[model samples]
Target: MNAWLDDWDGNIARTKGVCWIAGWDGDAMGLNQAGPSIRCGSLGEWNPDERMTRLVLIGTDIDENRVSDTLDRCLVRADEEGTSWNPERGPFPRR
Candidate 1:
């Protein structure tokens, strides 16, 4: 699919819920800034914003679905399936 700008009130810094997952096998969705939640202080360092870098994990990976479900709980959406996601806009809009 092509890149889209859904105009989400200028939130470039993607928090947990605001991020989407794009992987090799048809990209999963709802993967927060920290992919698949890990234990506290376990997900090692990475070069955020600059590029996508993998963090060093000390423990077994958490269930990605659990993380996705958790994100769903926090997300505020008008859609029922929680499929509606808004991307950031470019160059700002005119009032």
Candidate 2:
């Protein structure tokens, strides 16, 4: 399975309510979009061993500590996303 990530934008309603992340499970049936978009829960929940990344939305006004905790709770693996691309048209880079 694949992992999808999302962020919380600075929305007025969001400030008062819980923040939610959305993504494509690459499966949930829908219109033209090829991914399943959900709220706070993640598609990553389906794959316990999979690795997922989180990108904080720029406008979010929450504290950094809260963000870190959220990432730890949400990301599939606890490291940074793989940087750099394959030297050749080869496999994905290592984390």
Candidate 3:
């Protein structure tokens, strides 16, 4: 999967949401416009040893500490189940 992030403007940048593509394959959808902010929760093959989430924000004057603190509050532990082993996608969010 691939992603492209674009900032529309400085005014409504914070309120902008992501757009999903039903069948996005090499620009075959024909919905090619501007300002695409879609992102995936993870990238590349799943690694059982490394279960992590990395979010990338496109803006000016970005503070690493502030973003990390805000994200810590926004996301919480889904469950307390063991995420040690999985055949398909290792270390999945507890369901």
Candidate 4:
């Protein structure tokens, strides 16, 4: 998780846009601009059984597909039967 956060921070620092992430504990929510500044916080209540995340990015030259692809890699995949969502092998690969 720390490694992923570090990498995400680095990416946001280099990106020429605004970015925000909201999720459960250990995951930070923030508004990152093109600079060494990020205003971060939580998204209120967190329900462990229903874990989810919402990320938003906006910019003039942002590649929508690239952003989607990158973010999609961070998601917790659904099971084959679509009856389960597991974060055990998420981007951070946590259980």
Candidate 5:
């Protein structure tokens, strides 16, 4: 699972021209930054105008459907946060 996810992360970063980072916290898997969920943090680790980072969690035993749903929700929440994310612009587009 880790190998596959690493590949996926690399692919996302390469293809999207954005940083993709994730980690396991012994419970759910967390995405520190991915796709359109990018934003600046308190430390100013990211510049949304240039790059964005955000955290979203997907629990253990995840499947494709779960990943899709989580990303959709992330996009929605990002939009609510005033980000103009075009869901249709990425590999996963809210489906």
Candidate 6:
């Protein structure tokens, strides 16, 4: 999670007209390019662990498939033991 944020911050200058909403363990962070405002809060009072991340991006001239592919690579895959696992390294492509 920390690594993802770091990469986003590092490349923020190159992004435009987009919004990102990420949730983890019931907590969520929101950022919009319109005003570049950042907001964070629990999804609800009765927070429960979903153990998943959700991101929503809206903008012009963006390739939906590419964005989907990029985010898909960050997801955890099921191992032989039936446990979800993320890669040791971040999946975001390097600039």
Candidate 1 lDDT over residue span 1-95, tens digit each: 11122221122233232122222112222223333321111123223453332322122444556544544554344563434332232221111
Per-residue C-alpha lDDT of model 5 across residues 43-82, encoded as one tens digit per residue: 3244335444333433345455755554554433433543
lDDT of 1 at 57: 19
RMSD of each: 14.1, 14.2, 11.5, 7.6, 14.3, 8.1
lDDT of 3 by residue, 1-95 (tens): 12122323332233222222222111111112223433222223334454344333456666657655654643334562344323244221111
The digit string of per-residue lDDT tens for model 4 on 58-92 reads: 44566667766766665544543343333353342
Q: Model 1: runs farther than 4 Å from truth?
A: 1-59, 79-95
Residue 43, candidate 3: alpha-carbon lDDT: 24
Candidate 2 lDDT over residue span 5-84, tens digit each: 24442331222112222233322211111123333322223343442333333333557677567656654343533533
- Evaluated at residue 78, the lDDT of candidate 2 is 31
Can you list the residue pairs that collide in candidate 2?
Answer: 24-36, 25-36
TM-score head-to-head 2 vs 5, winner = 2
The count of residue-pair clashes in candidate 1 stands at: 1
The models' CA-based lDDT, in order, is 0.29, 0.32, 0.32, 0.42, 0.33, 0.38
TM-score, structure 5 vs. true: 0.24
Ranking by lDDT: 4, 6, 5, 3, 2, 1
**Model 6 residue 24 distance off true place after TM-score fit, in angstroms:** 5.0
TM-score order, best first, reads 4, 6, 3, 2, 5, 1
TM-score of every candidate relative to the true structure: 0.22, 0.25, 0.34, 0.40, 0.24, 0.38
User: How many backbone clashes does every candidate have?
Assistant: 1, 2, 0, 0, 3, 0
Which TM-score value belongs to model 6?
0.38
Best by lDDT: 4
* Candidate 6 segments exceeding 4 Å error: 1-54, 80-95
